[model samples]
Target: MKRQHSHLTPHHPLSGAETTAAEIVSGVDLTGRRAVVTGGASGVGVETARALASAGAEVTLAVRDTGAGARTTEDITATTGNQGGRVAHLDLADQDSVAAFVSAWEGALHILVNNAGVMASPELRTPEGWELQFATNHLGHFALALGLGPALARDGGARVVAVSSSAHHRSGVVFEDIHFRRRAYEPWSADGQSKTANVLFAVEAAKRRAADGVTVNALMPGGIRTDLQRHVSDAELARLRARAAGGAELEWKTPEHAPDPEAAALLWQDSQDTLAAKG
Candidate 1:
């Protein structure tokens, strides 16, 4: 079978264009669409929710802090004139919370954006005994996407966007000793693994749900200073930049190699088992 590609080309109007989410969907109206943006309480997540709502989509800000979520939802509603903006509680680090959020979700979902993440934190493990970064950044979103599979499959179709990072280029999934049991726990390495998992999760989910009209994709939204870097010190940031500069030549990723079928399958199965074991 030949490879399928997106209609968007390098010469497309949005191609090579630095644009805001609101501007990108300017002409496209999403009047009846419903979207869920995790971590939509602040930073890029906030802007994303606002943009989608501005485009006439009913956007739910899934946040860990209900207080912040409510405030963000209010702000979004006030700015977009779309009263559909609402807030819901979601703590990705907790599987029970993820399940609860899914259970409370209603109606068809037009879009799901896995936008929450943590970066460069000191070695720590979640209550589930998994590495904190890997568990929250990757597995949590993995469960969220699958849990919402039915919702996403409804209402014609749905798009799932996994917000990965260029940091994935630094490392691939480390199946062996994934929790840093055998080796020393390095923050960046764990983060890279999580980001790579995000890409793989998107690829595999897209493949599995394509028959149901659900599309999944992953992207790196460039470097932006956000709450995600709360754990990193200024000195650490400088050191990170210096390390990146001295590393191998950076290569831009193309959609051509975005979905690695084999890796996708491995990740999918791994995620399923991991989640099941936790349950």
Candidate 2:
């Protein structure tokens, strides 16, 4: 995908430089609200969970590691004095876990943050034969969001946030062979495709659920060193640094901007049909 340049228009009040999540949601109370943040056990996800809980929302840390998830939830409760935080096991790479999580969810959901993702891993496939990056980063989140539609729509106003990445500019979704069945598997390209899918998923979700008072948004949280980069090698890091030194600035965009609606609708339907077949 080519870069869609914007003229530095500020859409939100907070700049990544100095804005904390607590500061961004200041003055708004989330008491009685229910929220979920996938991958909330560590990294940026932990901060997101803490901020939501701080605002008094009942939060569930959907994590792959139950032990880590429990610890993270405890830490958030201690730091924010919000005891509504809890943990639920979720492995985006596994469909059974997705369904189980959905089944266990109770009551109306006000906020959902599809923040978990895997990046730059070796060529791998889920049990369903989908590419690992696409499966975990996009399709799994897609399924989770759709599965939670009843809870989200129960409330008049709800929000779903997909944490995409600036890497989306590198490539679009490989629709024809999303699993890399017929193409060579390159780490960066796989990661880029997954990120692109995240934005498109949000776009379609917004379009379909707008009438239900549920809005979906995608965001690129400005670069931060986190476990998300665990798969990157020393050589890859040096290469990235070299590119950064050459004046390649990572572009961040608000959720209002995404791929065309046509592409989004197509991806949405494709994802729906894919998941249905698997079921």
Candidate 3:
């Protein structure tokens, strides 16, 4: 299938499952670059921050748990010997927290990693009545990126990485009932919809921000057991493990299957409207 964006080049030879983050960025210099990784206190977020810091980027961990963020900062600094590591509080589910973080940010931002997310959680909602997964995984990151647009565009060649998942193939955005107002809540379906939104956000943001030299993309970090799976039961975990052992191939959704330009635009507008209404 034809790709819609020029930036969607073929995968790099080094991007295989065995490739580590450190290896991907080996010998690369980011001496004066500034980066922020949401949920940088744990999981892949910690590793991402460490790798960026190792590359000499001034890294900030935007996390809800400042204590954990501080601990991660120290660990990264100790491991990388890069004193530029810092931590700031950010709760993606809270618009005010996102706004404050954006407002507090200074100067150009070379990289923003939308890495924090909840998975397969029980039914939950934000103050605005938005589903918890969608709110944090998509809309919160959406607002953060939008708010930081100027900072991101200040210097050419800024990058925004949205951590989506292969699970996006499970479901597309249900515009009619995104928050499950009428529809019954199902954990994985909500997660899939939100993950799809992450991709759509990248698609639309890339198109709109291309003129600003801001590159946006989504990635599926192949199944690693992380705290993100905290909500899964033992039975479900065992089933997933069995499936993985069976060598089940992950079929990613094609652009034709979902995340079309029209859908992207509609989602962007709807997200804007939703946030505005809440305000």
Q: Pick the candidate with the highest lDDT.
A: 3
TM-score of each: 0.89, 0.90, 0.92
Candidate 1: worst 10 consecutive residues by lDDT? Answer: 3-12
TM-score of 1: 0.89
Each prediction's number of clashing residue pairs = 0, 0, 0
Candidate ranking under lDDT, highest first, comes to 3, 2, 1
Per-residue alpha-carbon lDDT of model 2 for 1-279, expressed as tens digits?
633321111124246667888888788899999999999998889999999999999999999998999999889889989989889999998989999999999889999999999998999998889999999999999989988999999977999999987777666776787789998998888888888888888878998999999988888886677898999987877877776577664532233443667777778888988899998
| lDDT (10s digit) by residue, model 1, range 203-253 | 778888899898887877766788899988889778767765777334423
Candidate-wise lDDT, in order: 0.82, 0.85, 0.88
Candidate 3 per-residue C-alpha lDDT over 26-115 given as tens digits, one digit per residue, 9 for 90 to 100: 999999999999999999999999999999999999999999999999999999999999899999999999999999999999999999
Largest TM-score belongs to which candidate? 3
Clashes in model 2: which pairs? Answer: none
Off by over 4 Å in 3: 1-14, 247-258
